[model samples]
Every structure is written in structure tokens, then in C-alpha cells.
Target: MSHGWSIARRLFLAHALFILVLAAFVGTASFVDARDRGYSETADRMLAVATAIADNPLVLEASRGADPSGSLQPYALRVAADADLDFITIMDTDRTRWTHPTTSEIGKEYIGAVGPALAGEPLTEVSTGTLGPSVRAVVPVTDEQGAVRALVAVGVTTSNVTIALNARLPAVLGLALALLAAGSIATWLLGRYLRRVTLGWGPEQLAQLFVYLDSVLHSVREGLVLVDPRGELVLYNDQAARLLGIPPRSPAGAAAGGAPLLADLDLPASLGELLQSGRPARDEIHPTGSRVLVVSQQPALASAAGRGKPAAMGSVATIRDHTDLQSLGNELQGMRTLSDALRAQTHEHSNRLHVLVSLMELGRIPEALEFATRDLELSQQLTDELVTSVDEPVIGALLMGKAAQAHELGIALTVEASGSLSDSGLLVQDLVTVLGNLMDNALDAAVSGEAPRTVDLRVSSTADALVIEVADSGPGVAAEAEEDVFRPGFSTKDPGAYGRGLGLALVRQTVARLGGSLVIGRHQGAVFTVTIPTHRSPEPTPAADQAQAPRA
Candidate 1:
């Protein structure tokens, strides 16, 4: 047979260990009990006969003197004859046999389980021999004065004990076999009962389990996915579907095999490597669309029984929507910037007010009036910018924030965006993604250049497309970085970096999805132009469910 993997081997070993432990316990207990019972029964009978002889007052008194020639010989003969026994012996306290039916045995020392009996208490035990285990007993003898004097002892060889034990041998063996059989049967019955309790429920439990699972799946705000060991998806949630732009329901189940519903979602290459290696991979899938998805993965631990064996294996993936989170973060930054601006303005205003009071006191009203007029002009400019925004709230707020940032950075921003886009067919959010990345890149390029840097921006729309163009006066694109500029994974920074930086690539993807085109070249500086068809709206996307085949 071929060697198996950890998971399969583990299952087999688990079952084997359980049986081994149970059998060992039962066998040990049985051996101990049978050994104890057999020894005790033999010993009990011998000790009783020995004690009866010790209890004889005549024998106790005679054993104390221990002169077998006069009293012991007669007593030993009388007892043996009366009990209808073969052998009998009486001893002094030192365990020397004083009376033996065989004259040679008299006055001989017999060592055995006789110490306690010689010390004035009756006792019994057994010792093993070449033939088998034997039983022996000792009983104390007392003098006429009631003082303990000697002991009475009796025993039989294993051969004799066996003749007596053979009568019960059938019953003993039968009981032992019954016990073993009962133990094995009991273990199996218990195992069956446990299985019934845990796995025998009908469809009611199955439905409830499914409902419970569904509730758990939906409760998780993050998209959760469970794949079989074969790397096929078995479970996926609503959030995962929505973030991937998958249909509400496909005729097939979630994560169906056919042309993956959101196949266009750029899965990281590292994830593929992880799957092959039985590891896990994760990264943020940033699509320049409505949302950013946080993809996470965890590899399933192989079942120990399948050690080094072919077995089912898979991983779990979670996708969380970070779009709202990004919006909240942006709002918080805006608030912080607003706070800083208010603090600075308030401090400056306080100083100016103090100066104005001093000037009025000094009758210098003209200088104070000039200061007030300048402040008024600045306020009016801010108000005009707010009213003449490029588009919706999210866009207008972002642009205003960027403008404030530029002013803080001492960088001049020449905003020349045209056309009323609030009513345009293009998603304002998608436009923001395209514009935001380009604007940020331009700003970064401008920062390292000479002082008083400027970024030229123009946004316009034609009858069939929405166009966005950005030109910066910084040093033109580096020759080396240009070729890989729009490549999917070719980033300007380190390869292992957390920032995927598919800004240009994301721009390309979003444009293509919207049935549009993009061009990049120099326009006296760095230039980027993107065009997307300006349809009224996209057609309602259909569900993408399809039947799936069983995993290999």
C-alpha cells in the first residue's frame, strides 16, 4: 500500500488508539480480578481449617511446650483423622513444626505465610511455583493461660489446588470471555449512540443549520468565502458579490466555475502562488470604480489523518468594502484641515483686531479700513469658488480640499476645469478616481521641482464622451518609467510595497469598462487624456449564476 497523508492517517490512528486504550483497561482489570479471586478462594479454605485446629485449646497448650512425642503426635493424628485430611502440622511461635503426621516432619522448620499466625493472629496468602500458584494459611495457637504460644499451618501443592479449582474452571473462563465480549460490544453501542445523537437528525436540523449559516454569512459585513479542499468556492456573501460587481444571483451558485462573474476583478498573482503551495495570500483589490475591496485569505490546515496523502483542501477568503471607510477618512481629514485653518485665522484675526483697536485709538482709520477690505475680498473669492463648483458635493468638496491643501503647501493651482458635468452620464465618483490619481501624481512631481510650482488641470466633455486631461510643468516623464507606466502591475516604487499604485492602470481599466479610451503623451509637460462613452446610463446588469461541476 502507498503511504498516506497526515489527515487520513490521523483518522485511522485516532480510531485505533481509542480501541487500544479501551481494550487495555478492560483486560488489565479482568486479569487483576481473576487473579485475586482465584488466590483468595484457595487461601480462604485452607486458612479456615488451619484456624479451627489453632482454636483447639488442647492443641494450643500442647504447642506451647512443643514436645511432640507426648501430646502433638496424638493431637495431629486425631485432627487429621477427624477432618478426613491427608496432612496437618502444628508449630511453636517460632514456626517450627512440633506435630507432623510424618515423624520426620515433626520438629522441622516450615517457612511460609506463617509470620502473622505465629505472632498470635491468623493469616493466609499464596505463592507461585513451577507447577502453578499455591494456597497456604497460618493460624495462632494460645496456651491454657490464654497467652499466645504457637501457630497452626496448612497448605496444598498447586497440583492439589488445581484438582479443586478444575470444578470452577469452566465458569471462570466463561465469565472472562463474557466480560471481554461485553466490553467490546458496549464500546460499539456507545459509539453508535453518540453518532446518532450528533449526526442522525433529519431534514429539520439540516434546514436550521442552513438558516443559521445564512444568518452568519449575511451578518458579516465583509465578504466571506468558503472553498472546498479542491479550491472551488462553496459559499460567498452579498457584500462579496456587490464589491466584485457580480449579479445579485446567477443561475449558478456563488463563485461558479464558468467565466467567473467578476472575472475582471484583478486577482493578485501572489494569491495564485499561495493556492498551489497550500499557503494563503491577501491584498487590496483597488478598482478605480465605485469601491475599494480588501481581499484576505487563510489556508485551511490539513487534517492530520491525511498526512502526506491526497485529500480535500481549500482556503477561506474575506472581502470588505472600504469605500465608505475611505469617505469617512476623507471627511475626517477635511475636518482636521478646517480646524487648523480656523485656528490660524482666529489667531491672525485676534492680532488684527488688536491692531485695529490700537489704530483707531491712534486715529489711523484708513489703514484699518484697507485691512478690512482685503479680508472681504478673500471671503468673496472663497464664496465664488463654492458656488461655481465643477460637479456634485463629493467632487466639489474634494476639489476645495485640494485647493486648500495647495495653498497650505505654498504651491499655486491653476484650476481651469470647464463644462457643467453634474448632469453628465459619467459617474462623478469614477471621474474623481481618474482625476484624483492624476492630480496627486502631478502634485508629487511638482513638489520636487523648482519653487512656485504649478499644475494645469482641464476637464471637458463632448457629445459622445467625457474627457479628462492633466498637464504639469515639472520635468517630463523619466524615459525608463514610461514604458511600464500603464502596465497592470508595473509600479514606479518597490514591487513588495503595500501600495499597488495601479493609478494609471486603474484609469485604463475603468475607461475600458465604460467602453472608453485613454491616451498618454507629453503636452509641453506630462499629459494624460481619458475618454469614456457618455451614454445616458448603463444597461441593467443581469444575474450571472450558472451550473457548476463537482471539484476534482
Candidate 2:
């Protein structure tokens, strides 16, 4: 439970202990086995010595004579010395000794089992005699008739067997030490690697950190993404995938070693380029498809243990959906524009009333009436045109407001719309986004252009698609910049201009979301034509609807 020792240290110590225990077991077993083998080999050697002495002719000849000790005793002592045996004895069938290494024991009864030896089968065993505990063998000597004549016994002491076993201890010990040394070295190397990777964190600490990170990744409302230095998407939560229009994490993406690369994903050019640059950005707004996002990114840094400075790892980005906020902001701007238009109309009406009052005072009532009638007719006609042309109320109101604003700015705004936009199969918000952005850009372009500043807007709905075009009598876009004009942060205006690029981008994004196309043309000025499919190119199926539904 203590955090003092890291995971690597604990594992290394465990392995070292295991190796030590194993070596001890092996060495002990080897020593025991050697001891056993030594005793058995000593018994075998004693047996062979006894058999050879028993078959000796000199011993056989002396066995029949009255003075057998004369030939046997000297020969037994010589054999014992030559064979390095503790003792050798020549005895009679009745268990009486004829010769012994201890000359005093001649003619004495042997102190061991001799019944089987007397019956002619040789026997080997461990027994205690005058020379102490020893492994001994006994054999019977036979004459010409194959009858038992005399017996020969030989033995080597247990102490000498132990000494032989001790001789092999060095080799067993050496092998065990070699095994332990090799194992320790390997464990040390593995520990060092683990320490570097884990940064010396214990198992419990790592587990807690993992749990915390997983919880934060899933719980946060904002989309979080991590990309490696190689531009491989290292990690992304469900929100990130959803916001980025990517497939949810599947088994393929979850594979430990198969993270998807950034280049493989269909990301917005602006977003992709930003991520690839690995530059830190704060609260940069970008549009992807129909959604507006506020993105912030920072360089991810990691420090090695004992290293002074952190190294650049990759990048971490957080994305928040700004579509709702952007929509609200646009709505506010439209309201402000209407308010401004209303204020201008009120001020002009007050001025006209003052003129009428002055004319009445001067008795010029008919001229005043004619002037008021002309102004009313002009406003009424424009209102009637907007009401009859645009079917959607929100879009109609938006155009009316934009037209009013354009008029106040000395820009002639003309609207030519026919047929109902009810069947456009596009959301009113999408239509508003597209039309509003185009109108605003057209107004700006016209106001900044030559003498006859004019903006023309045309809207129509057909069986297959709905078409909307806005043309400004301003400097048209250059041919080389046609493709990049709709990209976020691209503008033909001053480089230091702020909030001047996103209008076109939003227009393009809304069009794309509705399965629409936008075309740029030059007809006396910049022309923006948007075409949206009326009935959604391929209608959504019940299965697709179900798939898109949120789970409980």
C-alpha cells in the first residue's frame, strides 16, 4: 500500500527473490543427489573388491589349510591399502573371521549379517563394525565342488562418501550463482525501462490518473482532441467525433496501435490546416459545414524524469459549438438594423410633418399633400413587393430590413423574387443564414464601390431546386481568389480588418449543409449564386432516422 516503492522496483525485487529461492533449491537438491550417488557408488566398489578377493587362488588354497590366516591376512591388508577401503576381512562360513585389517580380530566372529553370504549369494549393506559405520559387501569363496569354502568382506566408511559429495559442491554453487546473476541483470534492465515510461509512478497512482482522465474526457461538454506529432489522432471523445462530423469510436479506432490519421479524416480545410500547423490558438472561430465552432489549442508538453525542460509532445485542442450563439448574435444584429431603419424612417416622417406644418402655415397645403403622397407610395410599393415575393415571413422580414439599411446607406437595393420558398425543403434558419450573409456582403461591397452603387437580389424556386443570387456593383473578386473567397479568414478587404471574413464562410457552410451549391461569377460586379435542392436529394430512410436518434 505504501507509495515509496514504484512498480518497477517492486517487480524487480520480486524477481530477484524468486531467483534466489530457485537457486537455493537447485543447489540443495544437487548436494543431496550427489550424497546419495556417492553412497551407492561406494557400495558397488566394495562389492566388486569382495568378489575379486573371494575368487583368489591363494585365498582358496589357504582356506582348506589349517593356517589360512598366513595367506589371507597379509593379502587382505594389501588389498585394503590398494583399493583405499577402510577395511577388508576374510571369514569362515560359520561367521568366524579368518583374517582382518585389525589383526587382533582374526578368528573372531564378524559383526554383520552373514547368513545370505554363507548361502553363496553375495550381499551389500551398510553396517557398523570395529571401523565404524560403512557400506560393506560380503561374498562366499567356493572350492572345486562349488561348495562354500571361505568368505570375503570389504567396506568403505560413510565419512569418505561424504567427502566425495563435498567435492562437487563448487560446481553446483557456480551454476546457481550464474543463473541468479543473469536473472538479476535482466530484471534490472526491464525495471529501468518501466521507470522511464511510468515516470516512477506506482500502480495505484497510475490507475487513479487513468480513471480521472477518462472521466474528464467523457464528462466535459466541450470536444477534446489529442493529436500526435505524426498527425495521427491519438485520442478523441464522443463529443469531438460528433462535432467534427466523424464516425463514433468503433472497434477499429479503439485498436491499441491503429489510431486514425488526421489526413484521412474529412475535416474542414481551415481546421485541418490549423491542426497541422501545431500553432497555439485561443478562441478562434471557424465554420465547418453548418456549425460554427470556437476552437482553442495548446502545445502538449511532456517532461522526462530528471529532465529540466519539458519537450513538445504534440497538440491538444478543445472545441465548443458556437452555432447557437452565432445565430443569436445574427438575430440581434438584424433587430438592431430594423431598429435603426425604423429610427431613420421616424426621423424622416417627423421632418415631413414639420414641412407640412410649415406649408400649412404658409397656405401651401396642396404641394405638401403631393410630397407626402409620393413618399408613402414609394415605401408602400417596396413593402408590397417583399410581401408578395417571399413566402417565408422570417426571410421576407430579413430582406426588408436589409433593403431599408441599404437605402439609408445610399445603395439601391432591388429584390426580384417569384414562386413560394415553402417547398425549398430547407430550414428557415439555413435560408436566413445564406440570404442574410449574402445581402450584408453585397451591401458592404456596394457602399464601398463607384458612383452607381447598387445591389440586386433574385430569389426563385423550381421543381428541383431553389435559386438565390446577390450581385454587388462593387469591385469584383479576382479570378485567382475565386476558390478561396469562401474559406474562413479569407477576405479581399484590408488585411487588418476584423470580422470581415466569416460572413462568406457561413454562407458557404449553410449552403453545403442543405445539399446546395454556391457559384461565383462576375457580371459588372461580384455575383454570388446559391442553389439548394428543393426535396433533399436522397430522402432520409426510416433506418437512417432511427440510427440518428439519441439513445436513452
Best-fitting candidate, scored by lDDT: 2
Worst 10 residues of 2 by lDDT: 248-257
TM-score of 2: 0.82
User: Which regions in candidate 2 have their CA more than 4 angstroms from the true location?
Assistant: 1-5, 51-55, 113-126, 139-148, 226-238, 244-281, 284-290, 306-315, 339-366, 447-451, 493-500, 536-552
lDDT of 2 by residue, 353-374 (tens): 9998998899998998998899
| CA-lDDT, candidates in order | 0.63, 0.86
Best by TM-score: 2
- All models, RMSD in angstroms: 21.0, 6.9
lDDT of 1 by residue, 1-552 (tens): 223222333334455566566656665665556556766876787788888877777775565453644786787778667764445667776657776667876666765666666566777766642223556677777765657777776665666655655666566556656665665566566555544333443345556777787888777888776655554445677776676555444324543554332224444343333433444656644444445555677765443333365334566777777656655654565566556556665776788789888888999899989888887799679746754747567666666656665566666776655665765677776777677667766766667567667777777765566777777766667767775676534654564554345566656666777888777678556777777777654434443222343446
